[model samples]
Target: MKHRRSIELQPPAGYAIETERQALATLPQWFVMHARCRACRHQTPIERRDVIRRCGDTLSLATLARRLTCRGCGNRSGNLLLLEKLPRD
Candidate 1:
């Protein structure tokens, strides 16, 4: 049988206690769910199907990326805000 879980997403004070403990250092768990666009300063929602993108600048690389492009423009950027890892196929 498949297990089902529901997650609540509310900005500012979104993350739950358990999720907070699972995070590294001081980073919040909701970071993976809320994505923002630099061009428009617009916030984009992250879906489980969205694939993680990497930067072209290799030397300055800091971490794994999971942002998508702006539907308004051709730009591909976002600050992933919320996410819940789904079951693997």
Candidate 2:
């Protein structure tokens, strides 16, 4: 009997992972944004409208992560952006 090899499938072209290449304006209204500090592990919810106003609607989430500063530890490096989905009524 011959052993079968597993095949890996790639996503369609123009497909991107969440948070990667995703802009603020593209986020759905039910999804909430959060900022987490890599150093202290502090997480806080961020307002989408406020972020859009300050950073503009075209700014990617990855770029926003780089610009975040930890309010707890005051760390500027390795900050993360998170998304939370809310249940629809």
Candidate 3:
């Protein structure tokens, strides 16, 4: 089946080393060094199912990428703390 890509070029279809680097650049050293949730200030693994549940299915690495919205605050991570890490290729 053909995968779908969002306008921003993210969504399983968005996996690219450069794209991942750009995504990582948006984050701070503390986030990459320490690693934590941009939402609720919760320091946890992004791989956790609950985190995925909170961020919605589109945030998944399995997908290309999408706008991350918090279920609790109804806020987007684009505005919230963007704690990003470079994915190893």
- What's the CA RMSD of model 1 in angstroms? 10.0
Give the C-alpha miss distance for residue 43 in model 3, angstroms.
5.2
> lDDT ranking from best to worst?
2, 1, 3
**Poorest 10 consecutive residues of model 1 by lDDT?**
54-63
**Cα lDDT of all candidates, in order?**
0.41, 0.81, 0.39
Residue 13's lDDT in candidate 1: 46
lDDT tens string, model 1, 19-78?
Answer: 323323344333345455667767665442232232332211113233355665556754
Task: Give the poorly placed runs of model 2, Cα more than 4 Å off.
Answer: 1-17
TM-score-sorted candidate list, best first: 2, 1, 3
Structural similarity to truth (TM-score) of each candidate: 0.32, 0.76, 0.23
Candidates 1 and 3: which is better by TM-score?
1
Best-fitting candidate, scored by lDDT:
2
